[model samples]
Target: MTKSAIRIALCVALVAAAAIVPAQAASGGAVAARSRSVILKHIAFHPRTAHIRVGGTVTWRWRDGSIVHNVVGSGFRSPTKAMGTYTLRFRARGTYNYVCTIHPGMTGKVIVG
Candidate 1:
């Protein structure tokens, strides 16, 4: 075989091997939801309730709006930010509730089981 043909073959083989690596790596890991999120909009939390497995993380993201907000719960308190995010990982199984202190009616819940 010509030298250039051998080089081209090696390049093709390397590309094929690279493509299979990610698929193999993903398949080797356990398949389970490990995180969730809620969006804090104008006056409420979208999907005010979320369900996640124990050891999963919950992220609260602030949307673009005039009014600022926060999340207060059993042991989690996200600082008020205009357009920021807060994340917490639950280690136990239970119902966790949170609310925005600035707004009376804004509430959310996280159920871990």
Candidate 2:
């Protein structure tokens, strides 16, 4: 094939492949459809980011061996606790970023769609 023709073919293939992939996946991010749980350990949230449908709930479990932490996100907040669990139900489709108020650099996010 001619150079021009090869370039056109490659562009077409790229467009087609992008159409078949989710925008998040195309951007090199992992999204879980039924993600309902997260773990708080070593002053960090396991699975730092999660994805779920609108109105889905995500449960945060504490397992840092007596280390206190809290999940503070946009429009939602959890009381500080060293053990047990906290649950938050997302109502809108958007990205929710959170952090540990006491621990610097501890962060997480949730994508609701």
Candidate 3:
């Protein structure tokens, strides 16, 4: 095939593939509505960045390995604990940033879509 024809075929294939991908809706969309877990240990949150669909939940489990820590973020905060679990539900489509109030440089984010 000629180069120009090959390029046209590739572009058509790319557009076709893109059209097959699912699309996310806005406002009261059908999110996967699942849960994710993160391990809080070693002075950090394991898997610092989590991705979930809108209306999903994230659970932060405290592994008994250090001082007190908590998950603090916009309109959400878990109690400081040495050993326990905290869960937050993401109801909106946005990014939620959190950190441990007692520990510096301890930060994480949850991306909701």
Q: lDDT by residue for model 1 over 2-56, one digit each (tens)?
A: 9999999999999999998888668844335478989998789988999988888
What is residue 69's positional error in candidate 3, in angstroms? Answer: 0.5
Superposed model 1: Cα runs more than 4 Å off: 1-33
lDDT (tens digit, per residue) of candidate 2 on 5-94:
999999999998888688766664545445588999988999999888876889999999989999997778999999999998887889
Report, for all candidates in order, the number of backbone clashes. 0, 0, 0
Which of the two, 1 or 3, has more TM-score?
3
Residue pairs whose backbone atoms clash in candidate 1: none
lDDT of each: 0.87, 0.88, 0.87
**Residues 57-85, model 3: lDDT tens digits:** 99999995757899999898999989989
Alpha-carbon deviation at 58 in model 2, angstroms: 0.5
Model 3 residue 80 lDDT?
92
Which candidate achieves the best TM-score against the true structure?
A: 3
Q: Candidate 2, which segments miss by more than 4 Å at Cα?
A: 1-35
